[model samples]
Target: MISVLFAVLTAISNGSASVLQRRAASTVPDAEAMHLSLIRHLLRKKVWLAGIGLVVVAAVCQAVALATGPIAVVQPIFVIELPATLLIASCAFRVRLSRSAWRGVASVTCGLALGMAAAAPGGGSESVPGYRWIPALIVTGVFEAALIIWSRRLRGNARAALLGLAAACGYALTAALMKDAVSRLDNGGGVLALVSAWQLYGMAVAGVGALFLLQNALQAGSLVASQPMLTLGDALISITYGVTLFGESLRSGWWLLPELIGVALIAAGCVELARSPLMTGAKPPPPRVR
Candidate 1:
C-alpha cells in the first residue's frame, strides 16, 4: 500500500512537472540544437524553476516506489500521468479534446489498468551486481545516442518521436540504477552508502541525459507525438529491466495474451490522440465548399 501510494504520488508530480515545463518552454526562445544555453535560459524563469522542483520531487517519489515495489508495478503507474496532464491542460489552456480523442484517452487509461492487474510481476533480487550493470549501461547508452542522432536528421513529429525514445531509454536506465541503489539500503548501506555508490552517479547522469532529451523532444514537435513513447516506452523498458536485470517475473503462459492486447489498445489510443487536432491547438479543417 505504501508503494502504491508513492507510485500515485510519482505520477501526479511527473504529470504536473511536464505541464509546467511545457509552460516554461513556451515562454522561452525555441531551441533546436538541444543546447546547454537552453537550460541556462529556462533556469532564469520562475515558471521553469517551479517545474524543476516538481521534477525533483517526482524523482524522490519514484525512488521510494521503486525501492519498495517491483519496477514493473511502479513504472506502469506512470502512465496515469498522461490522463492527468490532459485534464490539467484542458483546465489551463481551455482546450477540449474531441469526443474521439476522449475515447482514446479512455482506452489508454483502461489498458494500463487492466494490463498491470494481469501482469502482476513479482520476485526480484534485492540487488544487482555491478558487472551486470556495465553491459546494460553500455547498451542503453549506445542505443539512446543512436536514436538522438537519428532524431537530429529528421524534423517535426518524427524528430519528437525519436528524441522521446532516447529520453525513454535514458529514463529506464535511470530507474534501473535507482532500483539498485535503493535495494542496497536494506543491506546497512543507508543514505551515505547510496551517496557513495556508483549506481547513484549512473542515475544522476542518466537523469540529466533524459531531461536534455525531453527538452529537445518538446521543442521538436507536439506532445501528442512524444508522450506515447515517453510514457509507454518507459513502462515497456522498465519491465524489461525488471525481468532481465533484477530477476523479476511476470505471470507467463496465457497471461501474456492479455498483456499484449492491453499494449495494442494503448498503441491504438496513442495513434488516435496523436492525429487529433486538439494536440497542437490547431482548428479542425472546414467543411467542404461543395
Candidate 2:
C-alpha cells in the first residue's frame, strides 16, 4: 500500500535525522537543555541543519501517509526508526555492532509486524468532530506540561526519557491535526478550505513545539535513553489518538494476547539495543576470538 510504503520512507528519513540531530545536540552545554539557546546553538551546526532537511522530507512523507491511510497504521510503522538510527549510527561512526544489537533489531522488526497484524487497525473518520478535539487538546496539553515540569527536576537518562515521551505526544498531536486539516482537501473543499483550517495552523505550532522538545531530549543524554521513549512513546500515543479522537478500530478479545507479546518483544528489544555502545557513541570492547 502507498501509505505503508511512504510510512517506511518516513521512518528512514526520521532515523537519519535523529542520529544527525543527536550529534549536534550533544555539543551544547547541559545548562542549555530546554532553553532557546539550545536551538540557537543547534542552528549553527551544519549537521543539525542536515537533520532538519531530513525532517522536512519525513514530514512530507508522513503527510502523504496520513492522507492515504489510518493514523494507527501509519504512525506505528515508525517503530523501525530506532533500529534505523542505530544502523545508521553504526555506519556513520564505523563502529561494528555486536550480535545482540542485530538480534534487537530483528526482534523489533518482528514485534512490529506481529503487533500491527494483530491489531489490524482500521475504520476511522477522516475528520474528527470539533467538540471531540476540545477535550483531546486539553488533556494532551496538561500531560505534556506535566512531563516538562517533571523533567526539569531530573538529570541524565531520566530527563531524556521524560522529554522524549513529551515530544512523542506532541508529534502525535501534530499528526492528528495534520490528518484533520488535510481532510478538507479530501472532502473536496479545495485549497481555500485547507488554508483556512485551524487544524493546519495548530499542526504547525505543535510540530515546532515537538521539534523543540526533541532537541532537548537529545541534549539530555545518550540516544540509548531517548530513542526508545521517542520511538515507542510516539507509536503508543498516536494509537491512542487514533482510537479515541479519530474513532479508529483495533481487533480485540483473542488478539490481545499477540498484542501484549508484541509489545513485550518491542520493549525487550529496546532494552537490549539501549545497552549497546553504539547508542552512546562509545567505543566497543575488542572482539575476542578462539
Cα lDDT, all candidates:
0.80, 0.91
> What is the per-residue lDDT of model 1 for residues 1-290, given as tens digits with 9 covering 90 to 100?
77778988888788677656765665555552488987887888887788789899999999889989888888888877766666666677666666777888898888887798789888888689887887877788788879988887898889988988888888988998998998778889788998899888989999999998887786677777887888888989999999989999998889999998888777767666655644444565554466
TM-score of each: 0.88, 0.94
Please give the TM-score that candidate 1 achieves against the real structure: 0.88
Candidate 1 — which residues are off by over 4 angstroms?
26-32, 88-98, 271-290
lDDT of 2 by residue, 1-290 (tens): 99999999999899888878987999999888778999999999998999999999999999999999999999999988778778887897777788999999999999999999999999999999889999999999999999999999999989999999999999999999999999999999999999999999999999999999999999998787888888898999999999998999999999999998988888778877867876655677877776
The local lDDT score (0 to 100) that residue 152 gets in candidate 1 is: 74
Best by lDDT: 2
Q: Name the weakest run of 10 consecutive residues (lDDT summed) in model 1.
A: 278-287
Question: Deviation in angstroms for 102 in model 1?
Answer: 3.2
